[model samples]
Target: MNDKPAAPAFDRHMLEALVCPVTHATLSYDAERQELISHAAGLAFPIRAGIPIMLVDEARQIKADD
Candidate 1:
């Protein structure tokens, strides 16, 4: 049985305020991956169940490398 609460759906206003933690840049939501992608920084922050994974640790690094 799924024990997680359904994540709250974000509206346009909230999406506008969403930013990359690393670069503090704008993010584009990818409904497929349920992630907030920062193209400039090349990072894709995951969203679980519906809630966004805003934490750096939880985020998946994109084209950018260490």
Candidate 2:
């Protein structure tokens, strides 16, 4: 049996509608990292099991160098 979990598939339609919870700005999808990046908020929201966790508390703070 395959023990590895399948990668979450992001829906384009949903991505188009998602925005930053903090800044309320448009979000950009990072397929490689499976995250939704909010340049305005400087945070990256994680996508788990094909579901986007848009909570500000759950987001990762992004550094300027990153």
Q: Model 1, 27-48: lDDT tens per residue?
A: 9887767788888778888876
lDDT of 2 by residue, 1-66 (tens): 879977769896897788888878998888888899998989999999889999889999998556
In terms of lDDT, model 1 sits at 0.78
- Model 1 scores worst on lDDT over the 10 consecutive residues at 5-14
**Candidate 1 TM-score over all chains jointly:** 0.70
**Cα RMSD to the true fold for all candidates:** 4.1, 1.7
Clashing residue pairs in candidate 1 are: none
